[model samples]
Target chain A: MIKSLVSITGVALVCAALLAGVRYQTAPHIRANREAATWAVAFQLAGGPFPTNNVTLPLANLRIGGTRLDTVSTPGYGGSIEMLVALDRGSIGGVKVTRHEETPGLGDFIEGEWMNQFEQMQPMEVDTISGATITSLAIKRALQSHLRTALAETAPEGPPG
Target chain B: MTFRQAAIERNPAWVQLLGLCPLLAVSNSVVNALGLAFASTFVMAGSALIISLLRTLIPHDVRLPCFMMVIATFTTCAVMLLEAYTFDLYLSIALFVQIIVTNCMILGRLEAFAARQPPRAALADALGTSCGFAIALLVLGSVREIIGAGSLGAGLDSLFGPDAADWGIDFTDEGGGMLVALLPPGAFILAGLLLGLGRGIHEQRQARAHLRETEG
Candidate 1:
């Protein structure tokens, strides 16, 4: 039994040693990867391809210059999915799903080309992703807040378009 | 210990039912399920081998903790390897890969098999447990993926590299695929169906065996 204690302890020591050694080595790479992915997504969302310069989405660096959060939702297979879109300097700077209990695969309409549809569609136009009617409508309804905010910023006579 | 006994009797997911967390979570997609299954297999096998080899001297009092420590180590290594090499899968799987450390299957096998049996027996037990888990994951994954994504094993490039992009046969290629099945709710519904199906199969097999017994 004593021998067992010593043996197990030895294994513990080795594991701890490896953990101590490798965590530091991997952290930097993980951080970089996360940074790159975030920027790539943001760039794509900002109506541009990822830059070759490898710059991050400079949320902190860029002044807010004025921003508004608009709530949007569409019917999802699971339920209603509400999303919040951030308008910075009159452009769609950030978008996040606020309330979503969507079906795993079927309701993933928020991602991929489905989400991209929001870029071109008018807030009142209401674009739906074919089969994902509920999901797409939820997104459209959710965008009502953003539309309100847009209308508020631009008076009836002024063309923010 | 034959493979059959290990499967139906031991039944890692249902009978012993360890690792059900990941099984329940990732079983939404066959590819995700398979990725997890293979990684779990590697970790289980490695941990079992190491624990069994050192079982003789491990103090009874600390056996559980020591076993956990060993298993955690192998799981960590595999998790790191996956994240580093398989970035897309790593992205998709996210935290579930690390959560394998908490999987009762590996720990249960360690305590039950490695603590009591020889290294080879422990290995066999681990292999059996992994196989059963794999089978469960694959079935659930296939159902979910086929229903949700309209394709089985469609997103191969994310894991096996860009070359495997063509590996997945797309039903949507002809402009047809049920988009709803690809969401989270679809995963739950599909998994529930499979579980029910498994129960049905088990009941039929039992009824058949009972009939055979009567005839004999």
Candidate 2:
């Protein structure tokens, strides 16, 4: 019994060691690739017209990052919706209707291009999502609260909008 | 557990009730949940396969540390694959993807199923768990993607290839789309409704099965 156990344990160790080595070997490349992609998105979110390969700028004000807008819940035409606003500095960055729980065939465009109208629009210019009025109000109110909070808070030096 | 047993009978969500945070947090859309489910399954299966295969050699004194080392390695690989091939998905998932290393389901299956069973059985358990997980994720994704985006699998272009643009459906005419479904809070409520929906289906199936039994 002890011998069988030892053999099983030995096999386990050898297999794991081999797999671990493969993982470690490729770790650095994966890390670099992911970082590069994030930097690109940050610039895009910041409304940078040119691709600034430079990622981090600790010394500069208006660095780039995705600002998660105030999330709120409401009965949409489909179900529920989550509105995330990407902000650069105090200016509106970009708006992504991150998720929509509305009905698929009837009212799914809450996250589509039509919502782009609100991308850089001011807090007061909040528009309603057609076929999803309750969802629209909930989102607008949450965004207003976010804009209010952002105005109240000291702006972080992220990418300029 | 057997694949059938773990997947349907003793499901991690409906039955075992493990890993609910990541489950609920990531299950907002099919894309999000699918990304996470694949990552989680990879880690669980890879580690279990490695560990069970090596069950003969490791010293008992350092087994836990060894197990961790094995688990971490696979988790790192899962993250790397996402970063490489699915960079957008990787960014959307962000930290939650990394947190898979700490998910008890991986470790739990390692200890309970993998350690006690052979590599094949362990693989089966991992497959079962992931299948169960994928079902949950796909359900969530279908609900959120279809309802939130007004289409199913929108933005699958990036996932598929350049040619996929022709495949997506356009549902909006003007003043289209809801915002709440796309953001964070949507994740929470969307998942809740999906879970409720899953339960409702299960109950209906059970009721139908009972009716069939009575008639027979």
Return the top candidate by DockQ.
Answer: 1
Per-residue alpha-carbon lDDT of candidate 2 for residues A74-99, written as tens digits (9 for 90 to 100):
44556566554565556666665544
User: Candidate 1: where is the Cα deviation over 4 Å?
Assistant: A1-8, A18-32, A35-39, A42-161, B1-4, B173-189, B210-216
Q: Whole-model Cα lDDT per candidate?
A: 0.71, 0.67
lDDT of 2 at A103: 57
Model 1, span A1-161: residue lDDT tens: 76766777698887788677667677777666655665555444445543446433334222223554444456666876655465655555567653466665676757655554555656557556677776666666656555655757565776556
DockQ for all models: 0.26, 0.13
lDDT of 1 by residue, B28-111 (tens): 776788789888998898888888887776778888888788878877877777766676787788567788989988888788
CAPRI category for model 2:
incorrect
